[model samples]
Target: MTFFAEIFEGLRISWAAIRANRMRSVLTTLGVIIGVLTVTMMATAINGLNSTFQTSISIMGADVVYVQRFGWFMDRNEWLRSRNRREITMEQVRGVERQLTTAQAISPVAMTRKDLVYQRRNGGAVQIIGTTEKQVETGGLNMSQGRFFAAAEVEGARPVCVIGDDVATRMFPNESPLGRRLQVGDRTLEVVGVVEKRGRFLGMFSLDEVVFLPVTFFFNAYEQRPDLRIDVKVGSLAGIEETREELIGIMRKLRKTPPGAPDDFAINQQEAFVQNFNKVGGTIAALGLFVTGLSLFVGGIGIMNIMFVSVSERTKEIGIRRAIGAKRRTILLQFLIESVLLCVMGGIIALLLSAPITLVVALFLPAALSPSIILIALGVSITTGVISGFVPAYRASQMSPVDALRTE
Candidate 1:
């Protein structure tokens, strides 16, 4: 017979054997079902988190660099040292901007959280960002209505503000927020523009619960020395690294760091944040896979044990087949096929069960079911079947026809 014909014959025989002991076959597959479900769910959740993180960081503008007082992902000692470092100020921001030839836009940002009231509708704990007119360029925000605060307004520290989409919807649901007065702290400001909707970051923090105003106005109203963050947008994507180097040199001069002295300020970019996030994500994936592997290992052992029992119970049948024209290879193929079929069946059922579970998880966290995950789950199941069935299949193939007939 041809190779394909042999495989078909083995499959037919295996299916008949499984059907003859339907309950046993079903029970044997339970282990694999549970294993695949655990693995698939874990993969789905990890993939979802990765997808959501990428989307969230994209909103921060890949080409923009933030000059801050403290670095992200610093060690305890480094954090303590950075905490005592001088705060980045607007004077330093201007010094860097003056020498930056490769930069497209530069904005100094300061932020505070306060309660905002507009006609009895109150929004508590709203982030109020104080920035210059260049903020729109540096931030990559698109206007939904009206216009961003003008250069004149920022220079004059005018009582004007641009609200985020969530602020607009919640605070001004009944009317267009444009040209409306909103009380921020003890001062009342006019709403100049509304930002387009940018969804939540990491499925937790609301990106839209924000208010943007002139940095001068913020300093005036709060009367406090707020730490400033300098945001610089590069003129071209290819020149980002060059601009970063240039900015570092300029900032070092502005901060009056001695030659060869370690720089106090941190130049943070979106890629740095992504690299840190990837490290975290990779650790989570590794830990999850380790736990899931134990479950799959247990399932594989169950399959191997069940396959050994199956070979013992069908010894007489094996002898009868050997007595006929059947070869040892054929007997081995039949048992192996049966074991693989059982695992594949279990994998299919797990996928069906995982779909709804993934959907429910998506409602609360980022959870995705991708095609690669399905393929991997099925492949793992098939591999487990082959490895677990090998010994049993070899034993069945090695049986002597005479000895098999003697067994009752």
Candidate 2:
């Protein structure tokens, strides 16, 4: 018979065997199903989170640069050791302003977590950012009502504030917050503006849970040290590279870094932080995938074991076929097709199970299920079937008709 004829014959026989032992065949394919489901679901969720963060970061403006004593989201050791280090003061902002004319705007920010109260309503804890008017534009904050503080207002330590949407819902539910007075600790400040809903980033902190006041007011009300950080925006988006370098040089000069010494201050860009997050997340995902793959590998071995047993149980039937002039290669192909069919069946079933779960996840959480994941699952199952089917088919083909009959 031709190769095509042999494959047709093998597929028919394989189908018969699967139908004869339906439960056994299903149980055998379950391993591949579980493995494919786990990896695909995780990949979908990670992809969604990655997309969400990228969008959020893009809204913060591409040309913006954050200057601080430490880098953004550094290791615990780096943070703990840098505790006693000097803070980035407003002077650094002025120094960069003086040295670099490439930047369009620059301002420092000081932050604190405090309980806020207005009339009878109060929020548990809120982020209070003491920033200049430049932060209104540079930080991607949009005012929903009233105007931001002016440069003069910041310098004069004006008691003006801008609140976020979450605080708006909590502190001023009924009335418009504009022109109302909200108490930040012991001092009261006039609400100049309310920010529009900025949504959540990093899957944790809501951007709308913040309130902005002038840094001068923060200093007077809290008696805090000058531990503020600066954000700089370049004149042209294309000039960010040159602008970053110019800012770094100015900071180095202001900090008086000696010749050949590395910069004490750190400049962190949005892309850099996103890259770091992806690296760490990718590593964890890879590790989990590896562990899950091992389970599937063990399952593949079980499939091979079952196929071997089936070949042994049908030794007499095989001998009869060989006696009737069936070629050894034909016999081999039959068993190979049977094994592949088993895995393919499992792959189909697994995919069916995974689709709804993926859809549900995408609905509840920010995630995307890729078509590649389904293709990969199919490929892995087919490959597993072929590989595990080989040895049993080889053993069956080696059996002799006279001996196969004698055993019975």
TM-score of each: 0.94, 0.80
Q: Give model 2's TM-score versus the native structure.
A: 0.80
**Please, what is the whole-model Cα lDDT of each candidate in the order they appear?**
0.89, 0.82
RMSD of each: 1.9, 4.1
User: Which candidate tops lDDT?
Assistant: 1
Please write out the lDDT profile of model 1 over residues 167-249, one tens digit for every residue: 99999999999999999988999999999988888788888999999999998997457899999999567888998899889
With a 3 Å backbone cut-off (N, CA, C), the pairs that clash in candidate 2 are: 48-367
- Candidate 1 residues lying further than 4 Å off, grouped into runs, are 235-237, 405-408
**Over 4 Å off in model 2, which ranges?**
1-16, 45-49, 52-56, 59-63, 73-83, 143-156, 173-176, 234-241, 313-337, 348-368, 393-408
Clash-forming residue pairs, model 1 = none
- Candidate achieving the largest TM-score: 1
What's the CA RMSD of model 2 in angstroms? 4.1
